[model samples]
Target: MNQENNIVTRLGLCQRIEQLPQVDIGHYPTPLEPCPRLSEALGGPRIYIKREDCSGVAFGGNKIRQLTFTIGEAIHQNADTIVHGATTQSNHCRQAAAVAAQLGLKCYLRLSRDHKSLVQGNLLLDHLAGADVELVDAPFGPELDLVKYALADKLRSDGLRPYVIAAPQSTALAAVAFSWCIAEIHKQQQEMGIEADLIYAGSAGGTQAGLILGSKALGMKLQPVGVAPIYWEDKIDRIRQAANNAAKLLNLDFQIADDEISNTDAYIGQAYGVLTPECIQALKIVAQMEGIFLDPVYTSKAFAGLIDHIRKGKISSDQTVIFLHTGGTPALFAYNQELTDVPI
Candidate 1:
């Protein structure tokens, strides 16, 4: 619609979000820092990094944004424990554990046995945050979610109220949280006197969903490109559903269509959590050029895709782009063997 209408719509969405149960966890309006060196190196668009890594939670990451609502819902339900599951190096679990500790609730993380032998990265932080960590036989997606559900049920049997962060309701809340993140970015973009042409992030679901929903809601022209770090057959559908679910939650009239979602599975490499050569190079370049660290598993892969697009002339120099750094720098320590061979 018109500019005035767009502003009113965004404000209404924010009002609806504020009415929902939420906890104050992450540092808000994370700095939208310019990446001039990175832009120069690519010889591409003016680039900025949305410092979600500087979110000021445990070690900070995108999960902190989602956890504010997830954990808040847990507290609202009078949950004494929070149950979550993912890969061993899961940034979400690490942040969840920290938020749980901050809110004085017990946290149980049932991570897949992938990389279970090493306690270097997120798993180490999970423990440090006092979460009861368990390495399970399940894989990182649906299988791990089932394990979390069972754990939640068992907790209830023990007369303890437990909230599963991966539940459908909680995931929807996460999408709503990220939609608010879009609002923050829009305000920051206005302050900086430039509108971003594209926003890039590593996404399997909620983050991208929120980006799409938020853009549609605000009538912003920028496109959010989600570079998948993991392969999922229903990923696009999942994102669409999440956005729609979030819209419903906010009592919004619009829906996210399949055509509105932009994502790519090309950068995922061999599989989830498996680092590729491109990822290593991207990580090293960003670190050396901008003094920014991207985790091996997620952001590195997405940034690699962005770099490739710039090199291929897919993204023009005149455009402004924002790379969402969904922090997992701690995971860098976990990949010591893989990263040791790569030159700086």
Candidate 2:
């Protein structure tokens, strides 16, 4: 069958899911495996991990899933240049550059000046991708919108079709991709003879939204728990809405109700980007026990929450807990000082 027809029928299951217009960029069905050691250490139910880190395209991460659809849309829209803004070490920027390179489109990254010196991991890859980096001096609070408007205006005025990859603050397409991930998790779990009781991940809001909708659609009883590394009370709820919206866009009947949306804010320590002691400890434990590397910004902080929940007995000893390894190992190199004495 032709690619168009495959997308239309949503056939080939993994190859084409739900009529998605995606550019084949990242490897699919990222390994979902049982973490025997980590699970045993927690003394809770069985533990599993969705290894998105090994997604196998451009350093791999959860972002690639979303970019498949997003980049395709950009190509479909005839975008010749891709523009995005983020912190110095932005995974989205890295992933966007990889996709743009695959599609032979020009890529430009607008980086915030606040943390430029701490460039490592994804930040290094961002440079390796040879993306035209624009430094913005605007502070973290006011810089985002300023950069957005500036880039959009410049792109429009120059007659260049530029596509901006949505930032962590914007859930537009991120929520959609994660919803697909959640659906896949349900299938993989049933095949393994395991029923997941709870799902945990580091999220800005979009990833959690997708997981919630996907879980609901699968009719799975598992709870989607998002550990926020940033303090945004209503932020995750907005992602839930976006996830439901994405489902609706796909002609699926999924409800993202208030009760179904949930998360814990305990993991957000110090501030948004800074690492904390709990996050540092969680990173080391996961790496040592499971050989999984989580960045301080996202997965590490979220994992801390998972560890706390296990210790507090909020999650029973009989339930299965699955941690979504969103794959920000690139960010590890940037925090060498925090996680010193060994290579991140």
Candidate 3:
């Protein structure tokens, strides 16, 4: 590790990651807390939580880390406006809006869902942040890209240079943000003398990708396990590709193998954003026992999978696990109607 640059050039990643123009948008080294109550509830296999939910940006979330780099790129390019697209209650959109507001850049978000649902949670934050939000007729997919480009073109025509931060294919910059975290986590584990066996989360690929690449580059024994809440099929391959892509961006030789990228889709019951019984139970368990509020969509489902693994003895009684709380607590209100019927 190069102490001066904070880049572990031995792996060839942190150097390039440091070279990128990034701003500090999130509270780093989020608190790592031991979850004794939840651990005993599962009967064994001690569990710890990475509290990214307190990242300290407009309700806090993992997206703030990603935006720190991507938004930095916008400033590096001297862009006056930024554009993004997502579902109605996207944590990413909310964080992007907050970052843009903080940085004094004009921001716009094209959302797929309308605000028929209560104007609360992330949606309300997006509005409060003063982002120019537009409701799109199409769903969030390849089609949304067309609308975003059109909006950017319109902005260009109106004499403003716009930066589009939604790059599904190019995740190197976003991936680098989490890559540094892998090093932070390794240090935390070492300093605390905790030998965690598994580190899991609800992955959209970027976070899992960077961790997978970082684990290999840094030779960490524990790789990331992603609970896919989307892309029910081919999710692992997608994550593998994302890891490789990130490595390419960093000029690193690190490659995440098939088995190295661990994930499961059993908890993605129903569909995206549709709360399941296990999700509700996991949310209730963490909130009631630990006073930690997990969003209904991502962390809850991932934690449910972790719980399922423990209950089925897949995680064994002797092991320790870490659950990455990638924060979407603001989305809880968006699903208040559904959760009201979940029986706590």
Candidate 4:
């Protein structure tokens, strides 16, 4: 992919993406702003944040991008209800509920119970958006997925059309959505006259998958580094498959190779939704330095990984890095008890 070829391919990519059924949900072309103070504090590479936080719709987040296509498909199918599941504080579920409300569709969210389960943060917003919420015994991922499917079935039995948002097909669509996000980032990079060497985000799935697909498709030299918020043994393989699925949707010619996937589970301390000491420190540091808030469950952990790399001198000072702020600031409120002692 030379410069001319990259330009041509990106144009084609944008066209194909536009061809997909989508709803106007999130604010597009999210700002890629320089984090000068954050970079100076880290004493590392030049840092910028892709503000998916400011992506609009129910306080914004990465899920809004995915939901734009996912719910669009629901509307295309004439779905009357949207079913989704994840952990209690899941930004995905929060955004899903909000999007459903915006489009005048009913939403049912089955959230997995966790130690930090509270009627605050995303859960509060979930209810406020008029989503029928249930906190179940199941854990996030496959177990919770089954619950969502059952709910969809029940909805169908009740003579309603339900669309399961976390279904395999919808997950693939999410990856495609994120690939489009990568295209957005690429355009921003070109306009800024700077190219990122690496892009970091909290990922256990499609968000990272799309990053990989988009970077590969655009022939960008940058690597999409996924800092896992949860441990998944087959995360690498899952990301590859998701990326390939997205590529197929976009009519791209390449498949994502295993070697091309870069993800680390080292930052997921204890378990999913458990805040680590490093994560707490990361939240405080970013807030104090940049006046930006990173949610405890995801972005903070990933940012901790980035900070670890910087302090360990893993990234060169000259390299430009983009931290994808996938938004979950609302979760900050839910973690108030835990964050109470952390000094700024």
How far out, in Å, is residue 62 in model 3? 0.5
On lDDT, the leading prediction is: 1
Residue 40 accuracy (lDDT) in model 1: 94
TM-score of each: 0.96, 0.90, 0.93, 0.96
Provide the overall lDDT of each model, using Cα atoms, as 2-decimal numbers: 0.88, 0.76, 0.82, 0.88
lDDT winner between 1 and 3, please give it.
1
Better of 1 and 3 by TM-score: 1
> Residue 341 in model 1: shift from native, Å?
1.3
Q: In candidate 3, which residue ranges exceed 4 Å CA deviation?
A: 1-13, 114-117
Instruction: Give per-residue CA lDDT, model 4, range 21-74, as digits (tens).
Output: 889999989999999999999998999999999999999999899888888888
Where does candidate 1 have its weakest 10-residue lDDT segment? Answer: 1-10
Off by over 4 Å in 1: 1-8
Instruction: Please say which candidate is ahead in TM-score: 1 or 2.
Output: 1
Judge candidate 1 at residue 169 and give its lDDT. 75
Better of 3 and 4 by lDDT: 4
Error of 4 at 2 (Å): 5.7
lDDT of 2 by residue, 1-344 (tens): 11231122222333425576668777878889888998887787788989988887777988898887788778878889887777777787888887787778889888777654455687778777878876677654346757866786798798888876664424656776886787677668767877788999998577888777666655566778989878875675677677767766566654677777777778898788788888888898888998878877899899989999889989888888889999878888888877774444
Q: Using alpha carbons, what is the TM-score of model 3?
A: 0.93
- How many clashes in each candidate? 0, 1, 0, 0
Distance from true location, Cα of 163 in model 1, Å: 0.6
Clashing pairs in 4: none
Candidate 1 overall lDDT versus native: 0.88
